[model samples]
Target: MEFNFADRMSDLKGSAIREIFKVIAQPDIISFAGGVPSPDTYPVDALNEISQRLLVGNAAAYLNYGVTNGYPPLIEILKERLTKQGVVKDSDEMMITTGGQQGIDLAAKSILNKGDGLVCENPSFIGALNSFRTYEAELFGVTLQNDGLDVDEFKKTIKENKNIKIAYIIPTFQNPGGVTTSLEKRKKILEICKANGIIIIEDNPYGELRFKGEDVPTIKSLDTDGDTVIYVGSLSKVLSPGMRIGFVVANSKIIGKMEILKQVNDVHTNQFAQALAYEWLKNYDFEEHLEKARLLYKHKCELMLKTMDETFPEFVTYTRPEGGLFILCTINKEGIDSAEVVKACIDKKVAFVPGFTFMVDMTKTSNMFRLNYSTMSDEKIVEGIKILAGVLKTL
Candidate 1:
């Protein structure tokens, strides 16, 4: 049988990182491909206890259908937290979604029309790029510096592309690049977007995972009227990705639209997870857990960076992120093929994602790659880096 798919589906392909995940499932393969949180840090004991107590008494409430906006108690808890961070003034400004990824999709659904231009960092998150592509939006790429997106280039692109409707950014500890946007750069970008009347989708799943640097204020916090920025945050990194709980904070108008769009999507995020998250926040010592997780990641990141500095070829250069799960590395030699390096590494039971996979234009080749140090063991981190260094030497 011949199956017909939508035009957007014609160009949509499975994630290259996820494809790498398949190859690295063998126990021998040490993977740096996935942006997965460490299992060691998960509050399993607490979660198990909560689940049992809830199941014993409140099973029906959790098992039944829930409001599209979210579980009410969860919404209140999250709003309180965000308000403390200066992200939202009230609960009306936010709505829960399936995950940070789903928040990205609903933001695109609510605002982007076909052929609308979406500005993104050149090596942006693959998930967000795919979300925009599904809506048939035109993606324009801007270069990302150590601090953040090139503000001048972003302004130029917005001017050149009058149809550009939204700016998707991961300002703090950005995925794939793992570089935080400076406060000054964030202010400039916000000013430019506000002047251009463009919406800013601030996807910040890793904002709370900082280990080495002072917290930067969120763009959502800087929006004076709560209209210009749609903040997407996740419990996945800090808690559990399996819970599928995330949220969007924006103007009430945007939240209403997203809530409607969300109704047509998954109806609601998981009630059980929402309740669990609420309980965890309300009753548990979350800050202490976060600190412990940060310490683990800092150690792993330092080990990986140290190993790479001592072992990698001098021609290879990489970012030193203050925090977050990934580090972007580039081969200094021009025209160095990333596919050859990836293949060589995989042959030695190591895996990482090539940078081009995260770009708007997958057809373009890059000498860059992204590595994740959060999920691997200290031993595996050392072993994988040494193996990857050996592979690059062969190149």
Candidate 2:
């Protein structure tokens, strides 16, 4: 018998980052593929303490069915924290998600139907790009500059593209680009999106890991009324991704729609995990933990950048991100294929993601690739780059 599938499934493929893991799963291969928070920063002792008490004392709360939005205590704590940071408004509502990824998925679900126009940075996060594609949205890519999304290109794209239902951005410490959007640009982007009636999905998973720069006010915070922007935040970077704790801050209308979608998505995020995040944030010195993470990442990122500068060929240019886990590399010369470079490096037991997978249009090849610094050790980072450099010299 033949099987039927949805139209969206025809051309869609699994994430390149995840698929790369399957190919390079051997222990000897030094991988710079995942954007996971370092395990060294996990508050194991605190979580162990919280988990022990919660299981013995409050098993029902976690095990039993709960509201689709989230655990109430965790929600309240998040509301308070974000409000203090100027991200949450009195008129806005919030919902907890499985992770920041689901928040992006729900945003796509809330605003997009098939073939609706969607605007995002040229090389945005692969997860978000794929999520939007699942709805068969017509994606418009805005070129990225060192500061963030190019404002002129953004304005041009939005003006040229009609039927754009949603605009997505990662203003602070962006994923693959590893660049922060300037406040001037953020204001401009926000104003333009609001004027155009495009809902903004601000995916900020790495906002808390600012190891080298001053805080840039989030676009959601600038949206004082909280209607135009959907702020998607996660504890995956500073805390544990395994906890699957993420939240969305937006107006009641958007929140109401997402709440229903969440009900259908997974009913809600894990209850015990939510409780653990709540306890960690409210009781423990989370700021202290975050400080340690920042310092750790700072050292690793600097070491990686320095290694790249010294070992990599002069034709290779890359971003020096103040924060975030990635450093995006571009080969300056022409006719040198990105895939070939990746294959060569992989052959040498070193791996990083090729840049095309992160683009809105994946049909074209890219000369860029992304290197991650947070997951590997100092020795591995240096060793990986030396191996990569040797491969590039042959090109």
Best by lDDT: 1
lDDT per prediction? 0.91, 0.90
Query: What is residue 77's positional error in candidate 1, in angstroms?
Result: 0.9
Cα lDDT for residue 27, candidate 1 = 92
| Model 1 RMSD in angstroms | 1.1
> What does candidate 1's lDDT look like per residue over 1-395, in tens digits?
99887899988989998899899889998999889789998898999989998999879999999999999999899888899999986534789889999999998999999999999888999999999999999999999999999989999999999999999999999999999999999999999999999999999999998999799999989886647899999999999999989999988988899988888898899898999998888889989999998999999999999999999999999999888899999998878878678988898899999988988889878899999999999999999999999888766
Model 2 per-residue lDDT tens digits across residues 60-88? 97888888899899999989988999999
- Against the true structure, candidate 2 has what lDDT? 0.90
Model 2: runs farther than 4 Å from truth? none
Evaluated at residue 149, the lDDT of candidate 2 is: 91
